[model samples]
Target: MSPRNPMNARKQRIDDLAASSVVVDDAGTVDEAPGVSLIASAWRRLRRDPVFLLGAAITGLFILVAIIAPWIAPHDPDARLLIDQVSRQSNPIPGPQAGFPLGGDDRGRDLLSRLIVGSRQTLLVGVAATLLGLLGGLILGILAGAFGGAVDSFVMRAVDVMLSIPSLLLAVSIAALARQPSQWTVIIAIAVVQIPIFARLLRGSMLAQRSSDHVLAARALGVKRSAIIFRHMVPNSLGPVIVQSTLVLATSIIDAAALSFLGLGNPDDAKPEWGQMLGQAQQYIQDYPHLAIYPALCIVFVALGFTLMGESLREALDPKSRR
Candidate 1:
């Protein structure tokens, strides 16, 4: 055998070094822990946050009350009580008694029972209106974001027009136009007012996503426009929308209550609705303050629950918050 060529010897030495450097793990599976997703990280942060925990607890309690109102309520929300018969009182406006813990309203309905059952209606209206607004806003946002130029201009301009009008005023107008003023009418009115807000937020988020590096990369890879827009763009930009949805739920509840207060909610007095209860309690407000106090407290605390959760979620999901 001739003396080995220098270049071949050098190549063999390099290969030997490269082979020696390789260190494969004995385990078949990957040993490193899996990377946590953004949502998982946000959830972890939320769980650790006291504010979020408090809000979640309150919200859960209210939801539980709403769900089991009928079973938990001591008296039928519609049932009227005559305190004069029970307590031999000359005064008509009744105060708290054995059966009625909170108090009695002007029409002698059990305030506690009404409140318990009203929670169901209030939550229903709030959730339904929010869903309606979210659905409409999502559609408008997707249309504007996916199809730029005329479509974007038109949708945005329409949104701006809606935003220009006072939300409460617009809701009142919409409700007034309806054949019958009912809970659904109130929901529609509130949802209509909310459409512009969600539309604008989602549109802005989507527009920002459209220019993001991932979206650009997807486009460069010849991905279908629909896939790029729907899968990559929409999903990534949904964080802000979801956070906003929580905030919007609080506003929606307030709007529903306002509508009910204005006599634009369910006209039927028998149906236990918080706003309707508040409306009925107005006359006896000075006489029996508890009537207003209890319902008002319920509304305030529920709204607070949503607000705290929404804000905490917003903070947790914010990119700047990441270490």
Candidate 2:
């Protein structure tokens, strides 16, 4: 029989709106609640992206291979089988023969097994190198972004210097300086080259977010500098960096292969790697091109998987792409 208070009416309307908003469950299912977050929406978009699905399928396959290579491989990667067939004692570089689906290498090692087992090394180096660069870049970027002035200038200058040089050349130089060209050496080399890319990306992200509303609110509320940085600024800046890491992983894999192809990879060919296998096959390309083709194809497919995933994520996360 009486009119309601305007404030109470407004509150009721707000509650109704909130109740009608869509929320994303842990499993990514949408339900009626508060509005979905940007990340949740991005994830939904990614699931719908054919490109992302394709990439995920290929990436998952490679990851599966990396994890189960040893158990699934029919022979040890280093096992020399029927050398006479390879060394021309009995036959000339046999092609896809019995017990060797992909044929044997110059050393009579089964190409199929080596390729299978090599997935572990390739994925390991790619992931490790990307993480190494991501860690270094995060440290430098946060340091420079949170504490500008001399620190920022110095860090940016160093990054610029590194950027000026060709990334592969820098990696090659680092590998050359190492005591020996091993898997670790190749990882470190590629990681060093990747550092500047991530550093610059993160630094720019941080700087852009420094003036954002959340950051200003945190500062106004007297939040500790570290809390504002780690909880507010850095967290907000990570989406692009995370996407960039996937792309960097693809590059890292290629860089590792390049180093190995240049004869700067693992010293021992006994433990076969995709790059090392390709390298050894080079001299015999004219006689047995299959040896090189398979490894090269593996590298290409793996890289394509990462690239597609990264690009799809980028598109999904980009606000403009929603249109």
Candidate 3:
């Protein structure tokens, strides 16, 4: 009989340990458990997290409002309902009326209707940016992680350079460079800003997987490299990336609002957007700060929702959090 390779013996040992499964709890103690599925464990943890529940609720409500904006908005967002009450000098805006619970903006547009309807644009921009960014990152990250050496080094350097610039600054720069500043401009700029983040995240996760016992075992068993990467490594590396996407979704909304506020977003005042509304209110801010306050609050609460969910997801997915 041929003598066994020592490297093969080591791989087999590691493989056996991985198969038995090592579970770590918050106390930092590890225990052996067989047939433990990570997805099940993470889902169970998420179900019990109040933070995740709250985030989900807020996100769900935002989506609901966006979907039903047209039907639910009490007043026409584009109508100058209280124009008579608005005067740049004496009365910058109108106080809340019987129907207009939130009052009227400087332009005499119903603030409540604008707020309700604006959710659609916010949802569209945030979701579109996040999807595009995630797609771009997946392509770049996969190329770098699956093919190491020069490919990995080059990608990492670019990612590092992008990371050196603050996210909002990069987003602002990209948005400002647009020839025609619109919602699409906001979406694209935010997407571009997020690409390096997702790329670095995915690549780092994949790299960590390189030393995992399952990967080593797959190599020992002569599994095809492509299968080892896409089927095993990439899928496992997606947890953190998924969680990051939720957080990016929140950032995308804020960035969109900022771009609009800076006069780099949709130039049409007729279009109802939280950012645009906030920007228009700046001139009358001293006398009628409510215009800026409402939209700002909307942006803040919505962003907080996604952030909470993302943080909860991170905690739930961590191996140490398992019992």
Record all residue pairs in model 2 with backbone atoms less than 3 Å apart, i.e. clashing: none
Per-residue lDDT of candidate 1, residues 212-322 (tens digit): 999999989999999998899898878888899999999899888988999999999787888887887797688667778888999999999999999999999898864
Summed over model 3, clashes come to 0
TM-score of each: 0.86, 0.88, 0.85
Model 2 residue runs over 4 Å out of place are: 1-33, 88-92
**Considering TM-score, which of the candidate structures 1 and 3 is the better prediction for this target?**
1
Model 1 steric clash pairs: none
Residue-level error in angstroms, candidate 3, position 223: 4.0
Ranking by TM-score: 2, 1, 3
Local distance difference test values of all predictions, in order: 0.88, 0.89, 0.90
Q: Compose the digit string of candidate 2's lDDT tens values, residues 1-323.
A: 79889999999999998989566555565567878998898998889889999999999999999999999998887877857676455455766877788887777778899999999999999999999999999999998888889999999999999999999999999999988789999999999899988889899999998999999998999999999999989999999999999899999999999999999889887777888888888988886788899999999999999999999999888888663
Regions more than 4 Å wrong, model 3: 1-36, 220-222, 321-323
